[model samples]
Target chain A: MIICKVVGHVWATKKEEHLNGQKLMVVRETENGGGTYVAADLVGAGIGELVLVISGSTARMALGGNNTPSDMAIVGIIDNLEMETT
Target chain B: MIICKVVGHVWATKKEEHLNGQKLMVVRETENGGGTYVAADLVGAGIGELVLVISGSTARMALGGNNTPSDMAIVGIIDNLEMETT
Candidate 1:
């Protein structure tokens, strides 16, 4: 999973039928200035929250096998990341 | 799906049991000098072929829902890509 921050929302009145009712968000990877991509919200993640995203086909699995043509999905809301001072 | 060229192969004898019997190949995205990632080969793609890859959980779907921890899989071989000259 990649770390991302919910930046904004994406809406379309007409789109793929399977994509209806899906909440789309614009997210940018948290590290290294990764490019942004549209992701479906699986968890109730909010804007500016750190989220865990699983992309590609794994993302579609979150839609109950809907095959929505989306390649990214927010999978979790991360609380923190602690590193060991080794 | 991303277009990539097969650069090399990876082998791990000891790994998640679910990952056993999976063939791993190193791929470089065709458009950008995108960093490499290990991808499971679903098609019998060769070393020099340009391939279409579906990554993340979609990759695991190629494994029959085994939930194999893989994140990328080669979905097709690219024979031609035609674009209109406008």
Candidate 2:
């Protein structure tokens, strides 16, 4: 999992049937500045909120089963993230 | 999953027991330059080779079972990747 900032929404009506009823949001990596990618939202994340993103099979499993075609998902809304400065 | 370029190797003698005997290679996203991350190599990929990477539960499944603690994996060596620029 990684920390990301919810940047935008992806409104897709013509998408995979498995993705129906799922909320898709664009998130950018907070720590590494990894470019934005679309992720299914489970935590009702608002734009500009810092969130925790998980990818792969874990993503699909989190959505209830392995039928969903999600490769990434917002699993948590982070309240605080502490990092030590070296 | 996405296409990435193998840039280097990760030599770790002390790692998760499930990771033993697995080859870990560092990959950088090819198109987006999404920076670098380490992935277990499923295919025989070498440095500078373009490969297909999969993450999350799919990675752990590809490694064999749920016992492996892998989140990313190199699944294929790309012979070619075609994209049309608009």
Candidate 3:
């Protein structure tokens, strides 16, 4: 998973059948200034929260292989990131 | 899944326990001139073969949640990519 900050929410009344009622959020990847992408929200991540976004089949697994037609999923809300000193 | 072409192989005698015996291949994503990255191979894709790669938890599902410390997996060898006439 990659570190991303929730930038905004997306609303689409009509979409893939399996995606109904799921929250979609705009996320910006925190590495190398990667641009924004929409991702299905697995956790109740609010805007401005640090989150872990899992992509691909893992994103599909979020809904138990129901074919959500999305590549990214917010799997967790990161509370903190700490580093250790050598 | 994203389309990529296997470029080379990687060998690491010591790695995450779940990654033992898995084949690692270098891949270059076939979009927007993306750079190369390492991914675990699932479809026996050889160098220069266009393949589908799944990332994140989907990658972990490649090994049944064994925590393989990888973010990508070669899921299929693409025989063709056809776009219908607009």
Candidates 1 onward: DockQ, in order: 0.07, 0.09, 0.08
Cα lDDT tens digits, model 3, B1-86, are 88777776655443334456777776777674654556778777888899998877668867557344446788899998986545
Which consecutive 10 residues in model 3 chain B have the weakest lDDT in total? B10-19
Model 1 docking tier (incorrect/acceptable/medium/high): incorrect
Candidate 3: Cα lDDT at B6: 77
Going through the candidates in the order shown, the clash numbers are 4, 2, 1
Per-model TM-score, in order, reads 0.52, 0.53, 0.53
| Chain A TM-score values, per prediction | 0.89, 0.93, 0.87
Across residues B1-86, which tens digit of lDDT does each residue of candidate 1 receive?
88878876654443434556877776767665454555778898878789998866667777568355456788899999876545
Compute the lDDT of residue B8 as modeled in candidate 3: 66
TM-score of 3: 0.53
Q: In terms of lDDT, which candidate is stronger, 1 or 2?
A: 2
User: By DockQ, is 1 or 3 better?
Assistant: 3
Among incorrect, acceptable, medium and high, the docking class of model 3 is: incorrect
